[model samples]
Target: MSTVKQLIPHDQALLVTGSLNAMEDDRGHDDRSLIHPVQIVLDGDVINCSCFDSLGELGVSALVVVQKDPLVTYITTGADLIELSIENDGSAQVRRIEIPALKDVHEMSLLDGVLWLANTGYDEAVAIDLDEKCVVKRIVLGKFRGKIRASLPSFTGNDIQAVDRYHCNQVFQDINGKLCALVHHTSGKQLLKRIARKVIKSQGDGGVVDLDTGQAVSLSLKGPHSVRCVNGDYWVCDSGSRMLNVYDATWRLKNRLPTHGWGRGADFSKHHGLYYVGISAERKRYRDRPDYNDRNLIEVFKTDDGELLGEIPIVDGIEQINNVYLLQRGVVETLLGLKLSSWV
Candidate 1:
């Protein structure tokens, strides 16, 4: 058994991993490289594991475990939605659902049998019927409304105008059972200002947005992602500041731990006592930062105090990590050499 497996409790069955660019190449320009962007069964300690090797195209982002018997992962590949099912025998099945209205889909979450997509390219959070695979309704991200018109080619009547102003990327059901999201930035102008060096941290505008009531509360975050409600408190990856911001149940900032890399994926397991976080590689866009030399990796931290526990570096073949999830053994299973795992 590998060190990672040994460190993790034996009760843990599998590990789910997602990467933005699977290949160790120039990701911004290369799109043809169909490297396996998702990995399963972390059987080794050196970050070397068996993974599904193909998913059509790259730019793969978020992953979620919807149902287990035959393990299922709803993954986002750019604007595409992929359903990968892994069975008990390790065979696999892949289904490509056509969502004409989807534009630049990002981190998603399944709630109440509905899949909520963070349509970043459209500046909206859309809910789709799980059974019909068709869009049911979409809530325009409040900040982006009136800023730009929706121009998505597949966007029909009643759909919000497509204009990416806030760059909303993650959507999930809060602990209160309300829909919420983590917007990358509050305004495109603020984003541009940061790129232009006119500001220091884009005003730390990327905060939590209440999708249900169309209200937003600023937590003074910078380039945040992976906003999740755990144990009734909100934990978010403040990516720009390289920190994890934890808020109390009443939405008060309680803890801000300095994570030593560009933080992205943030998740907590039912196993308790720890949190899993994905620290991405410092690519060209991050060339100006001090940790630009840091390798893409995932770190385990103490959930109570945000103290670092361990890390898994993506050196063997992978490059950039987009998300990380904890899978309980026998909950969901994946094949050895396939991205299309069986729905066992």
Candidate 2:
């Protein structure tokens, strides 16, 4: 059996992509550079990447892993145009969820064993009942639910691996159960029209649809991207336009963080009272440069007053020299393959 690098992170399941580079000088196994290997069952399987953005030796050119559960891990190739799903037992499943009218399937959240997504179309998400192995429900989160079959088109590229350009949907649930979906707000719209848009997104403010009646309780506000639930309240990471909008369990706007940027992901490690936020500097510049970024570093801060701590560089180790490992017996026998190392 391959030596599965164990020291997994606190939110190991949420990790979408990662790598295993050789920090020291040891070139035993070193050629899989471009493939965005999302899931690594063993340590290293097969790296046939088309990694664009950067080149050379992968500081992290091993696997792109995203996990939500110990048993459930989703990993995709850098540019192979196909995502991979691997089980902890080293078992594998391949899929390209080709649903008509799909945009982008952003990071997912599992609540009560149900997967919730966000988007501008119907139901907002495609809920999969893992046990049942079927789509139990599709959240139609728009005013044009029954009528709008497909989500509005996006303004991005489909060059990334496994991304069909259709799975780009988003979803957010407030502590009070408010489900706010993102929308394309064109600039310079009439005042009444803007009001109408607000009313439509206010569907699930005081708690989502009635479990008994299937009715939506309209809230007065909308939630931005990236939200974390704490003590039944939501601390939203409004990354877009550089803002941190706060809301109550009822989806009411409470406050906003003056300090903000294009936040890709966030985690509050109460262990150290540290809030680690991942950001891409490119968001501010080259706004027109379309490829979804992978260059920004991580921002560290305190949870209490949101004081600035420091920045952890998320550099693509395509050129790292110490992360090393090998493929043996179905495991990424990384000295930290796939990204861990012997020192750990």
Candidate 3:
């Protein structure tokens, strides 16, 4: 068994989000009763788990730590954005905001108080105002009449159509402070062709697109998930190929580190010179496959040399890891606050 000390410092903790295997529905539909919403915290040798049953089966996907002073965290389900506020006195509050027309929200980032979400189901990226708690802009990624719209005017759920052509799963801010997307398909033309043929497949040809420039900065990726800019370098999770691809400041390929599983959620700890990457089990589509029971874990790597340091196994009931975030032990203890006793 791998120990947490091998993965991170004793004063650091990791926040993980995923689906519980036993609570998942066999049919793949979002059944509220079958969904178990929980937050898993790995601190020291203790695994702290908290269940938010009141969230009503929204199904957790991606999350971001938006604030540190008050310790605020935002989580996304397909249908809602849940905000968690932790007070210094060890009390926490939860708020759920309804976001219509959001489908398969995979990853999100916060910039200038606006939360940007990769709305995968609708083939668009959405910007939600943190203060107003509402969507402020929608950047359409799919082709309408063979052309991609710069932005959609509609805001309601029923106003737009669901195409999911590009499978835009992760949204982040580049090193130059530009908003970008990690799409599962290479180009708009390829996506349109697949839609026309009714054959949707995730090939190892996805790329990163600059939302502002309307151009692809990097290409030829396999099922990419998380993209993080660290000290001017771009580190991407090439999940489809089970590798972590690093790029220089010029977006040139620098290194490819093997993750040994389906790479998805990831975060970096500059304080420790390490990278925490989530390696999840293959999805339910591969239920009968030989690797279906593969171990789910967080692989730690040395950022300086791209060395595989160690891994922290995700045990208990969680089967799928959607995101992994590193936090200081002080902030984590404050977030858990009064709830730590009941959770641990």
How would you encode candidate 2's per-residue C-alpha lDDT over 1-344 as one tens digit per residue? 11113211223211223333322332323555532323222321223222221221232221222342322322212111123444555444554433345333344555666654443223355565644545676754433323323222222332212111111134455455645443222110101212322312111122233222234333221223345765455555554444455566675766665433455455555545655554544422234655444354445555566566655443442321111111123233221223211110
Q: How does model 3 score by TM-score?
A: 0.81
Assess every candidate by TM-score: 0.80, 0.51, 0.81
Query: What's the alpha carbon RMSD for model 1?
Result: 7.1
- Per-residue CA lDDT of model 3 for 185-265, tens digit only, reads 645533322344343343555777777666764357767888888767989888878899999978899999987788988
- Give lDDT tens digits, candidate 1, residues 1-344: 12455445555533444444543444544544434565543544433234444443554666678877777767776677878777777777778777776776767888888888888788788887867878888877755454432222222233233333677888877777777777765443342222243323233666666776556666666678888777777888888788888898767999987776778776677456767788876666567865565576667777767777776665534456676777664553343434424322
The local distance difference test score of each candidate is 0.64, 0.37, 0.71
Instruction: State the local distance difference test value for candidate 2.
Output: 0.37
What's the best-to-worst order under lDDT? 3, 1, 2
Query: Which pairs of residues have clashing backbones in candidate 3?
Result: none
Stretch of 10 with least lDDT, candidate 2:
184-193
lDDT head-to-head 1 vs 2, winner = 1
Shift of residue 324 alpha carbon in model 2, Å: 24
lDDT of residue 6 for candidate 3: 60
